[model samples]
Target: MIDKQEQSLNVKMYINGEWRESSNIQKRSIINPANGSIIGYSEEATIEDAREAIKAAREAFDSGVWSNLSTGERAEFLFKIADKIIENREELARLETLDNGKPYREAEADVDDAAACFRYYAGLITKPSGQTYDVPAPIQAMVIREPIGVCGLIVPWNYPLLMGVWKIAPALAAGNTIVFKPSEVTPVTSKKLLEIFEEVELPKGVANMVLGAGSIVGNEIVENKDVDKISFTGGTVTGKHIMRTAADTVKKVSLELGGKSPNIIFADADFETAVDYALFGIYAGSGQICAAGSRILVEESIHDRFVEKFVDRANQIIVGPGSDLESEMGPLVSEEHLNKVLSYIELGKKEGAALAAGGSRLTENGLDKGYFVAPTVFVDVRQDMRIVREEIFGPVAVIQKFKNEQEAIKLANDSEYGLAGGVFTQDGAKGLRVVKKLRAGITWVNTYHFTFNEAPWGGYKQSGFGRGLGTFGLEEFQEVKQININLEVEPIGWFK
Candidate 1:
């Protein structure tokens, strides 16, 4: 557990293996959303600070000090970082919970996942095999994969450290230098991660972190010509802006954006299991997850029964400070976010969805200062309602009824976002059939909101473009080169 004195430590931006304040010395307060208290401060990096970080990464990539290391050697460095993460797991989890307002158990799980990600990528980097093409007359052809040079990683506050590790682990494993920017709202764990990088004795300028607002620091990372690629995880609006800005240099871009994922429950599903996963799906992380199953499409046959159980379970959730080990749900990230979520609840009423349970802020007892909202459930929702279509990053679930498999598929695919969805059924055939029809990158048969380090995670449509975990994630940071060799030293007739 972090003591009071440790919580007050000043956090600085990391650049070129050194921790320093912003060039302009601007600082932003880091708040503990669980209690609306200031935990510490982080440097609000200037455009110059961002540029220097980018330059550092570019120089490191060009110098080949880090990128030129053997793949096995690079793997060893990633393993060391993974080990350090395990050694400091408790502290990292505490910092994450404090900074992001998640339950300590959830935060601890994220730390484990982060370490696993590094180890997974480390193993992948050492695994041999590029494609070898069978050539026609007296020639050999093959494809070689190389790092894509400097990468600018922009991570969100929802899962601060885990998201950073998602991008950084794979990028580094692929031998790319990085300039990362953690969300200003939650920079605590990110700062700690940089310290771990230093502890692992990673080369200078190989990994950099700039803490600040999106306008200055984020924009610099996107517009900087030296940065070869951009990997961003955030809202869709900001993602589109990054895409447009990166177009100036035509840099490689990978995005994991917003989602209004659907969780479909058929009448044939195991009633108790579906009810449990339904609550776990949206209420986990207080519904801040990108793949959160906020939109529930229940078959009309089981709609009424499922709604009853789901609401009852939601009401029983223990909402309190993340530092409390027994708490099931923590506060929202900030007061501003609380207001936004409340406004959405009101909008749901305006759109004519019945609030089955929880529709207001919880201010009873000592919870007045924290941004606390109860686990909310809405029934009688239409496909076109804003509550059903928009990504509400809160512990709110909108339940809608579908007549049959075709209508269920239609309602599930009706949204502009398609990051993930799930189908709950006991029949193997039906589960496979429904999953195939859903227009999502990932679909769960009996589960929801569970991701693995071995699988690819991304979206199919406007939700986002590129994949994030697994070998595909490493490939995102790599460039493929096709090589051809002539065995007989013959000149081409066309060139002659």
Candidate 2:
């Protein structure tokens, strides 16, 4: 059931902390995943509108109005933004569920996570320090951390508000202005957030939003010379394009991109726990998460038993409307994404991987309307299969068998992506030892999807670089400045 709490909020792009209609002022229907109804529409942003957002953010940054604020003062405002998010969690969560086609509880939890991110960075900025060192007998050198200036933040649709918070909070905490673009598929929750600070808000151009496709607004934002830094989280191809666009001006860039993460099960592992972890990693968030554990590497001894348990749990996943709350899996972000994920299913079968269960869309259960795909499991998949090496980005798991710990590590490390992975074992020591060899940014022991506000998050290899959370994440927004002063009243020039 679509909640009545989803108020009819038709919002436009928020530029310069002011909500304004695009000159195009056009709106596109946002589908309700429950029954695929047109629930709401968002005002589309044009290239001109994107330019305006960039101009505003650049103006705010160059003027040093927001950037020059004291770290303590900036931290206070950051907390104020966090407080605003906490105050409206329910309404904002509801908006998130409607736009992103995710379960309400998870959406609500993401909103809470979003709030915690801001609060964490709010406290973190106050602790940022620069080095004070002796330069000579008469001179001392002091280094200060300064804001990097205007930031261009491009977020993905899978976790709209969460991704937004991940980038926005740290950018603001580091005393940088921002020009952000939320994915067009899910802008409702983002818009509701803009409305949170109607009365007391950040400096006028401190935070701004542009709405449009990546081909349009994103290109404008990332390529603009006024934009000092570009932070993006999306597919690898798009991230590469963003990086290339930033090259002209040599703007600072950070990208958290694609993943084909592996979930490895050792023969010495706890079977039940491994099964649960493997199931959740591939199926949670409807397998829309960038870190979704898509590859399953099992030891040869327990491969049969593990696949049985994993397939059983995967079979039980209920594919229905995200509004149902009880539904364990929801639709893909859009029809195109659904088709793309579906096409991979066909390829998996053709590549000689055995389809264990749920090979097609859920046209049964009167769910012929929404973009619903059945939770799928492919067994006896070779390491060479496309299903084993690629990111399906759907509720599909490909099971591959390995002979020993060494083989498991080699097979897991064979992928082009290394965002996240998990290891299961009964011996705690062995589990810790194997995680060190996995070559992934985040490693889980006896579980999957373990995340927190304090831990840094990013990926290795094709997965992209620069952490998105924790102290390291915030540091990405700053530039180091060193100052040298001559204590001796004598002039110092080139050792003269």
Candidate 3:
């Protein structure tokens, strides 16, 4: 239970259109990462509770109450949800900041982005249906897309609400009933979103939320035979586990896993813009982003200058509580994550990388009680070093120099994960050429971490399969069927 001394929040699970406590009567504390305060508590659902959510989704899908609605009708509900998000943007943003330890401004932006996602999907749902093809003889053929029954959506803690919308909006717009599992670490905004769902009068069992540990709640979502598909965003290890478990039921799975994305800067690039983006790429979200450009491959010609500028900027970042609004960076999400990041920093030092700036935890002033880490930068990093190769998921960046464009491409593609990469070059032809060579799914030419709802987002190699956002994301929750009709029947001579 959360301490009554701090602010209290409602943290009930939404199952079958009702907000209720966990069946097992267990609860988990929700911490405010900014100051290590107990902000709220959530129902810790058991496996049985998870099964109930799944059953609800299954029944809803079978009922066809939501699935049978016209595309335009479904779009209406999504638009309403978007409207509600805008109406309560500040409140939702504050809750997100409190739960996830991101700056209030960033959390607000996430709220707006989430609303935009729903609106985008709303417009998309009404645009197209399927394709009709002309066939030889008297047969007519066509392909149609239909909902894939009950969907299980498991989202992570970093961009809690936005990631939830990313999965839910598309799943709902595709006309599939959903059972969403938000990370136990940050379930505040998700519970609030369900409140909006109730306000919008979303049909019973059409959308459900189960709050608990991943081992129980998430496992139920993956292994349950009733769930037609599972869309997961988390670490690669957990993703692999979901894949293995879902295989028993042969459920359709779409995973957006980990990344060790590369941000390459060439000497010919705009120096100031490249440097700023390099910092933004890694430092934004405290480097907790899956697409955080943790690996920086700089052209050897400008390596010294870039590192100098980058370090100067990183040192100037104000670290404090997310609610301060004046602070540029906030604390890590939890004590455990902070220690994990510190361990990685130590590993980087032991592996012989030079700490350029901001390499240790900050406990100055009132920040001692918070999980704050200084924006750390390391130069002279080797390609094979753990700091350079792994996803630290902190505000840490490693700088390595590449001699030429060929070497830049080689180093960028050397990773087992290929979620995203960026190349900064002023030459248009050279930028396109390098972009084509990068193995990542999403690559920015002169920009670093800009993503739009209209563009496809996913990765190659071990970064996981399938796509999210844009038209492709909508298609992930749908199944295609080919329908053929014969206008005339003819008997073969051999049959007579």
Candidate 4:
């Protein structure tokens, strides 16, 4: 268990293999959203500090110390990092719960997944890459993948450590240096992750971190010419800004952004299973997931029955501090995010949606001090309602009814965002048929919120572009180069 003094220690930014204070010495108080108490302090980086990090990453890449290492050698570092993460699993999970306001079990699962991600990349990078091609007579051709140097990795407060690992592991595996920035409000776990890198004796300047607000620090990384790529997991609006900024230098950009994914339940689905998964879809992590199934679409015939069971489950969810093992759900990440969620609930009522279960904050049982909101559900919501269309990013969901498979498909794919979606039905063929029509990048037949490190994750359209995880993840950080050789020295004829 983490003691009080250990929990509240000051965390410094990691730059060029050293732990140091911010250039301006600005620090942000890290609050435990579960109890609304100040848990720690993290240095807030300025533009100058962000620039120094980028410079360090660029110099590290150019030095060939890390980039020139063999694939097997680099894999060794990743494997050690993975091993250390498991060794520190319990402490990191507690820190995650304290800093991010997630349930202890959820935090533990995230820690395990984070370690697994590192191991996955370590093995993937060691595989034989590049392909030889057949070409015209006397000519040999091939293609090889090389790392794009000096990556800029920016992750949101939700799933802080896991998302950071999602980018860091692959970039390092591809032999690139990086400037990593975690959200200022939740920098605790990220600081610990960097410390793990230090423990593994990762090369100097190969992995650097700058902690601060996105407006200053993130913009610096996006706008810097020396940074070769930007991998961001956050809101779509910020992603658009990054795309435009990176365009100036034509830096490769990978964005995994917003989602209002759909969870469709047909009448034929197992009643109990459908109801349980529907609650899990939106209530896990207090519905802060990027690919959360916030929009539930049910067949018209069984709509009422489904709503009744789902709302019952939502009300039974225990809302309390993440440290308590009894707590099934935790508070929102911060007071500001809580207000944003509450305002959305009000808007839903004004838009004429009926409140099915909860629509107010939970103040009883000492929850008033924390950023707690009851798991909320709005039924009879129209397809055009803002509450149904927009991503609330909270434990709020909207239910809508559909007539048939085609109608369900239409309703599910109507949204501008298409990150993830799910279908639940007894008919095996029907499940596949519906899943194929859904426009999201990630989908499940009868499950929700189940993701694997071996599969790719991303979205289409406004949900942002590019993929993360699997071999596709390694490809994002690499540049493809084509090469040709003249077996008979015949290249001179064309030039002559």
Candidate 5:
């Protein structure tokens, strides 16, 4: 358990490889969402601070001090960072749980995956890059990939360290200098990551962390001319604004935005497994995941039974502070987010959805001061209901019935966002067919929320563009250049 003594550690911003205070010497309280206590304080960076970080990255990229290194050289730093993360895994996981209000075990898993992400990219970058085209003989045409300079990476609070690493590992692997920003509400792990970078002796300005609110610091990163690309993972509305702001400079932008993904369970699915995953999909991470399967679409024949089973499991979830070893789920990240989720639940009821189980905040079990909402489920929800259409981003699930596969597909694809979804069926062919037609970038046949660092991740439609992870994620930070050589130069003069 994190004690009040941990509050003595003052978190600072990392710029140009140095830990320092914001220009204005401003700071914000870093609250533990589990109990609304001030765990620590973080630097509240200003526009000037953001510019300082950006200028550092821009200068580093132009100087080629870090980017000029061989792929093998860059991989060394990533490998070291990954090792350090593992060495400090327990402390990092505890920080994540306290700062983000996720269970300790989940936070530990995130830390492990974060390390794996760095290792994956370190190994991946050493592979062959660029390709030779089989154009006409002697034409000698080929395309080579190079790093895009000065990336501004913005990640949401939901997966603070993991999401930030998702961008950091690849961006660094591709040899791009970066100005990274964590959500203002969750800066603890990012600060720790900066310390890891410093310990690894990553070149000054290769990676800079600016801790501040999005409106000031994030806006500066987006609108700044020196930044070559921006990769953001957050709300859909913020992503749209980023797109609009980035267009001013016509900078490259990749967004991994919001989703209300569906988990479909056919009557033929293994009933117990379907119910189990459905609960895991929404309740894990307190349903704060962008790809969380908040919508459970069940076959009409088994909808009732599935809902009954799901609700029972949801009610059984132990909601408490992440510090508690027995707690299966933790509080929402903040009170504001908790209210937003509760509002959506109320909207669902008003819209005629049946409140199946656990709608209100949990005040018992020593959770009175925390931002805890009980695992909520709503049945008989309409497609048009705000609760069904919009993202609640909490421990909430709404189950809707579909008569058949066609109806299932329709309900799943009706959303404007297509980040991720899953289906469960005994029939392999049916699962594949439905998954292919789900209109999502990431889908699973028998699993939910299972991700790999080697796989491409992103979404279709409003879920945002471009891919993260895998070879595609590495390419996101790269620019392709085509080279053509004229082997035989013959001047055929048309003019006499």
Candidate 6:
């Protein structure tokens, strides 16, 4: 439905509440990863642009333009922003699909999630409780929570606008100004989102967007001393770099990193439901999801049987262009990611794991031009192999067998990641019992990668610090300030 007019679009960088063409102007072609076509283009930002953003955010924070607003006022702005997002949901979804190459339905859901995130944070703005304390000896104390300060929000290409809303919303709700940087690969969606705020009447510089690669503009945001808080969501390697870079300023930091989640199948599981959720887990985003259930652990008793049904069910999936409404699986985000996934599939073969149904890239259907990878499943996989051990963000699922509860728990926790995992079982007590022992942050019983707004989402260990999407999310924005009050108005004789 998109015509040439939509395809030949220019995405401008947003700064200080104004659309600004980059001064150090270099344009980057943003391609549709699914079809390998240039969908849109954006002006790349430089260090000078980053400096301006930091200054704008710092000025907005120090001037009390955004931070000093009453909680109710902030809440109103957030609510208005959510409304504005709703108004532009269709346009935003189109931009997301064009730039990120996700199905319109999937992208629309992300847009909905983005809107919900703002509302969730809007409700929380008025809820951060400052406690009044009682103490003996004519002394009283109170503790207050205050925004950390100007925030530099760095989001990944996979889910640009959603991640932006997640990081920026809570920071704003807790009374902080932000300079948001969406990834170079998918910059237009966030840029398109900034347009919604035009009528929302947000304070200038309170919410800003800068575009560029992570090496330059993103680096500037992290290393700048003026930026007080750094909220980052990306791969663990880049996350570590952000942590190290932020340490120079000792800026408050929160990270949501990568995952190699385990999907465990017990003997009592409803195979029909488990298989359905499992396919959604591994193939929904062409396995590009950070929390994709790449490692599937099945009990030895049902291992063979489940693999057969899983393959049969998986084969029914339609793989084609993301724009195709009926298509179940699309290409990996880019050629690089496609090659990386193919390497993992090839490794599984070399390591002697049996390929149940799919193992290589697809080129048979009338769709040979796109960067598509077939939905792949490998059986009899071991924990030591690269395909099993590493986070392969692709449509490949590795099936391994476990004998008992002890081994299931062991295999699930064996990975270096403690991000997320799924345990499928009919027995709630047994599922909770096993999940409690598993080391991942978000555990789903009878489900895999479905995240909710009410629950806090984050990982343990190297999976990274901080939680998103709940009351715990508000805690990340604030630093505790304790105040002491002398309740005894009667002057102490010594003090008098």
Which consecutive 10 residues in model 2 have the weakest lDDT in total? 1-10
Please, what are the lDDT tens digits per residue for candidate 2 over residues 385-406? 8887877788988888888888
- In model 2, the runs with Cα more than 4 Å from the true position are 5-7, 493-496
Per-residue alpha-carbon lDDT of model 6 for 1-496, expressed as tens digits?
3322266768887788888888865698877776677776788898999899889889989999988899999999889989888888888887777777777788889999999999988987787598987777577888999998888899887888888888888888999999999888888778767877767888998888888889999999999999988888889999999999999989988898988889899999998998899889898878888888988899999988898999998888888766777777767777777888888888889998889878877877655556788889988777788888888888889889999989999989998888898999999999999999988889899987788777898998788999987888888888899998776687567863
Deviation from native of the Cα of residue 91 in model 2, angstroms: 1.0
- For model 6, state the Cα shift of residue 357 in Å: 2.5
lDDT of each: 0.91, 0.85, 0.93, 0.93, 0.93, 0.85
TM-score of each: 0.98, 0.97, 0.98, 0.98, 0.98, 0.96
Q: After superposition, how far is residue 50 of candidate 2 from its true place, in Å?
A: 1.1
User: Which segments of model 1 are wrong by more than 4 Å?
Assistant: 1-7, 490-496
Candidate 5's residue-wise lDDT over 1-496, tens digit each?
5432366557898999899898776579888888888878888998999999999999999999988999999999999999999999999999898899899999999999999999999999999988887786668999999999999999999999999999999999999999999999999999899999999999999999998899999999999999999999999999999999999999999999999999999999999998989889999999999999999999999888888888998999998988888889899999899999999988888899999999999998678899999999999888999899898999999999999999999999999999999999999999999999999999999889999999999999999999999999999999999999888788756787
Query: Model 5 segments beyond 4 Å from truth?
Result: 1-5, 489-496
In candidate 2 the C-alpha lDDT for residue 343 amounts to 96
Write candidate 3's Cα lDDT for 121-239 as tens digits.
Answer: 99999996899888776888999999999999999999999999999999999999999999999999998899999999999999999998999899989989999999999999999
lDDT, residue 480, model 3: 99
Model 3 local distance difference test score: 0.93
What's model 3's lDDT at 79? 100
Give per-residue lDDT, candidate 4, residue 305: 86
Error of 6 at 297 (Å): 0.4
CA displacement after TM-score superposition, residue 304 of candidate 1 (Å): 1.5
Q: Pairing residues by index, what is the TM-score of model 4? A: 0.98
Q: What is the Cα-based lDDT of residue 295 in candidate 5?
A: 93
Expressed as tens digits, the lDDT of each residue in 164-273 for candidate 4 is 99999999999999999998889888988999999999999999999889999999999999999999999999999999999999999999999999999999999899
